[model samples]
Target: MARIIHRLYNERAFRRERVIRDRSNPLDIYNDEELIERFRFCRRDLFELIEELTPDLEFVSDRNAALPPSLQLLIALRFYANGAFQNTVGDMVCVHRSTACRVIRRVSLALSRRLARYVHLPNEAEAAAMKQQFRQASGIHGIVGCIDGTHVQIQAPSENEYLYVNRKGYHSVNVQIACDANYKIINLVARWPGSTHDSRILRESALLQDFEEGRCNGLLLGDSGYPLKRWLMTPLVAPTTDQERRYNTIHSATRSVVERCIGVLKRRFYCLHGEMRMHPERVCTVIAACTVLHNICISKRIPLPRHHQPLPVPEEDVRPRPAVGIEDIAGRLVRAQIINQL
Candidate 1:
């Protein structure tokens, strides 16, 4: 009887010890000295966002490696940072392939939910403040924000070839974004089919609906690909010999803010530059998370590349009247004037 009791006690002690050891160990994945250090810095934003949004989410142990919440987040950011495959991530983190996938998916969902709070469309007061800032920065009065769509490459799905194929002959996802005059992302809409026209997507987006209902007041600057609307502005299409060329030049210069913003985003996050290998549904989530990350980095005053200097305007020269009818010229002038008023 004494021997049996001793054996039972030893077994219980052994199980408790094993549990304690498991709880304390973290799985280290990457040995890249710089990456490890950088990942440590990246955790703060994710941690704060998660804590603020989901106060109840806690790090719990599973049968596989019991990853801490912070470490789990680190894994996702690391995935974005390097754009590596799951097998590669598993090798780096010292986990199995399945474990790496699970970690990434869990972290992605958590971050997406937490980060959504930060990317909402601005209210009236907030929109007014943004307008004032834009007026001050760009000297463009009555400007609320700029809107544009960019294509992100993705792996082609065998089932829906046309839906995913873009004009560029690649599988892509269209991400439409709205930014304040100060070039901060105010809102993002990412669910449109890749082949959808930018103008059509904008019409269907909440931004257009809100503006139409007078819930929001701001003009979105867009390229000619978008239709001309009272709430949206596009540059005057070239209609004459000299004026047409000048308008084109000016339009390209002014519309460059959105282009620069997109460039900076893709440059900073290498994962976005190439085709995203993840499922189609997750593409939107990844884009949103990256935008949120961009905002966080901006708020933290992360250094970004300086805006390119605008090209010098060409010398004005009087040109002979075009053979086109006077009615055409007058119509073009009217359209240009309407755009200017907006």
Candidate 2:
């Protein structure tokens, strides 16, 4: 009886010593507009996100006082919104720095897992509508999407650190984004290192393969860094004639859709606006997850921040690559045909 009583007392003491951090409602401190300002998600949108992510984020066991899924999301969003230190951001919700880091990764991964649902190539009907929209908006016919690559800065990694260094003389991951006329990201490829060229990133992507096989309809407009494939159009490097110059101007303007999408993405998620201190792998995951969230915000018509954060460094590095390989004759013919039509 004495030993059992002692064990019970020890158990009670241990329970008392364990800490359960307080989770406050951000809505209490910040009104709807203020909350959106801080976290970039209005309350209604936030609740919708929380509901969507709860199934993946909620813990099965309540051990050690697991964070409420809503709190977990808020903590992650705060990190994403401002790119502040983990501890500093976590303190807003009374979680440890480590806990905040883990939560950010968790929430990022959760969103990334659902990336296919949010980001994807347009289907048959969707593609037809997108083609018309692109033509109407840019005066460039048959443009289904615009593509570009942006370098996301990151802390030096443990393995192959040299490969992460970009021409801007910094560490980063080169993320390729493809967006439609409306600045909505349709597809994203985020796994490549910063040293990888924009053309190579496209050359090796399944997106290119799908286009090669004629799986998706319409041409994709890209900057000169990409090859002028039959399905991918690049502006003429030397346009001697007025019509050629006009085509170049139109191509540049049409391709700027992807650039604007990148701008809005970084503007919305400041974490991508600056260097991310996580590992390269985590950085990739975070980028993809952010892309997914960016699409959601675009669909819901979330207002872009009034102040534009500086866009990512110019990616059309050093004009066209020196070794662009043999030009695709078929691609040249396509451009010429479009030029005549124009």
Candidate 3:
């Protein structure tokens, strides 16, 4: 009898904790600003996302009524916008913490259904315009995008843990991102371990095939950590002449587009900025989902969250001797042409 009474008391408390004071949706209590503040998206965009992900999120389960697609998206977005613990975010919506964790995974993989739509290489029409913009902005001709690798911090994995330790002495994933001048993520490669060199990631990527096979035209501006290909240009190791100095200046300005793109991406979704607690495979999916959403936010002209701004991209290598790109003869000729023009 005493144990039964104790159990009843705990059940009542749990029921009260799950109940919202006055609203059906906890989201209704917040204004548009608060909605954006908490979820990084207004109701309209959130609803659209809900509609797109509804099919993917639909299911038959005991938790169905409690975990609708919209609410699941809300929970996931809240997690992404603020890298708080699962239980903490779960508390905001009155769901159990375990439910929140499952919802985050579900919503993340659901978003994956639309991944290829938003993130893609520029088409023929986009390439011409992008090249013109790159030329006008930095006087760097025929440049369509900038490529760079940024380390997304992650919790130490149980398997092959040493592979994830980057040069910074932290476990991370080295994500390669290429973006057009308009701060759009045109291409991304997110599966490499942090210990892998940025140049190696590019070397093994299909993006190189795009350039090599003529599927994608226009030059790419990358840092010294990437090899200098005929279609990819890197900064000079040492600039002696005025022309070489001018080339490096313009190259950096052009490359800063991708850097700022990364800054905006991590700023919009704080999950990428901090140590994500999920498995690496799931974390990569979340990163892909974030990139898709990042492109959407850019397209919709959504304002950045307060205090969110582009970060200065740090160098990948901080050792006594920084790594430089492997020089290619044809690439050198192409880079010289641009410098001479400058």
Instruction: Rank by TM-score, highest first.
Output: 2, 3, 1
lDDT of 3 at 156: 98
Put down candidate 3 lDDT per residue, 50-142, tens digits, no spaces. 898988887767453557777888889999998899999888777878888999999988777677899899999999999999999888778
Q: All candidates' lDDT scores? A: 0.63, 0.86, 0.86
Q: What digit string (tens of lDDT, one per residue) describes model 1 on residues 1-342?
A: 999999999998777442222221122433434433334223344556555534333455464446656555555666765577877766654565676788777666665774556676678887888768666654455567777788888888666768988766888888888776445687788776688778778767777778778788766667766666666656654446565555455545555666777766676565777888877778778887778777776666554433323223333223421221122343345446643543
Q: Model 2: which residue pairs collide? A: none
Question: If both were scored by TM-score, which would come out higher, candidate 1 or candidate 2?
Answer: 2
- Name the weakest run of 10 consecutive residues (lDDT summed) in model 3: 315-324
Query: Can you write out model 2's per-residue Cα lDDT over 145-228, one digit (the tens) per residue?
Result: 998888999999999999999988999999989999878898899998999888888878889888989889889998877888
Model 2: weakest 10-residue lDDT segment is: 315-324
Q: Scored by Cα lDDT, where does model 2 land?
A: 0.86
TM-score of 1: 0.73
lDDT of 2 at 158: 91
**Which residue segments of model 3 deviate by more than 4 Å?**
1-24, 61-64, 313-326
Error of 2 at 148 (Å): 0.5
| Model 2 / residue 2 / CA error / Å | 23
TM-score of 2: 0.91
